[model samples]
Target: MTTTPARERTRHEIVRQAMGLFQDRGYSAVSLQDIASAAGCSKATVLYHFNGKAAVLAAVLEPAAADLAALVAAADQLSRAAAQEFAIGEFTDLAVRYRGVMDVVQELIPFIQEMPELALLVADGIRLKGFLAGSDDPLEQDLAGFALNGLTAECRHADGRTDEELHRLCEAALNRLFRPS
Candidate 1:
């Protein structure tokens, strides 16, 4: 059965509230009661909307994935150089936005072997591999994606590195990844 508008509103409210809480406190620390309180509803309402914490975590990941997809699609509109910069910027934004969820992704990596839906959300991120100039080569694309993932981690944890310096490093990494042999 489909949710009524009011119910859908309540569900959206619950997820939105949960996103902020999860982002601030991470996956393990947040409780259903906390989401309900933040959404100005009862704990039962939170439970009704989401079965449990994992569902909420998946919901939180959805928007970040969508945002990255949109950013990557938009890069197609720019000059190749600008598009590369856009790709790196998009990568950096996701790392910054989901710093809290990093551990969750890491922990789930092994378990996703049996969780297709959960893994699909992550698969969407692999589209980022297309940013490589040698994207026609699947191996190169995969390598570039892994390298960019590392760059994002570097950018996220870079102690006192100026934004310009971090961006330069990211660009240089991408350049090295796709540079003609």
Candidate 2:
């Protein structure tokens, strides 16, 4: 369907407001009225633009999800070591760029398995974890992957840090995590 400019603008606004609400309040705590209030639209207008809250959440997460999928696909084509470096760099870039979304995603973990719209993100996350770990042993790789994931997620909560600063900090921590012992 061809979206009129006004409709597109309203959709964008809804997604933008939904992202902040989801980040600040968590998905379960946010209501259609809350999103509508933040977006300066009526709840029915929100429903007109999106099917419901889950749809709004999907729209809010779409950009970051697309970037992550692309990163995973690109990294999948490289050698193990090259993929590791590529994934780490790309993942840190994503983590910093989508810090708020990262927090939302972290909060959504408990529900991700049940959200069909988030299935690609969940799969890409698994692939990204493997690339980030870059270890030969299964146990070591799992441990390293979880640590890297936790580190990136926690860094998003570093108040008062600029994006550049967060990028550097996350990149350095990731590199150190993957560095040979």
**Which portions of model 2 show Cα errors greater than 4 Å?**
1-4
Q: Worst ten-residue run, lDDT, model 2?
A: 147-156
> Clash pairs of candidate 1?
none
Candidate 2 residue lDDT tens string, 1-181: 8757988999999999998888778888999999999999999999998888888988998999999999999998999989999988999889988888888888787778888877888888888888888767798578766865685576658688988888888888878878655
Model 1, range 1-181, lDDT digits (tens) per residue?
A: 9757998888888888887776567555789889889999999887787777777777766776677768767877887667666776676566555554553464455454455546656655665666654356768767876785576557546677776666667666666666644
lDDT of each: 0.68, 0.85
Question: How many angstroms is residue 41 displaced in model 1 relative to the true structure, after the best TM-score fit?
Answer: 5.2
Report each candidate's C-alpha RMSD, comma-separated, in the order given: 5.7, 2.7
In model 2, the Cα lDDT at residue 6 comes to 89
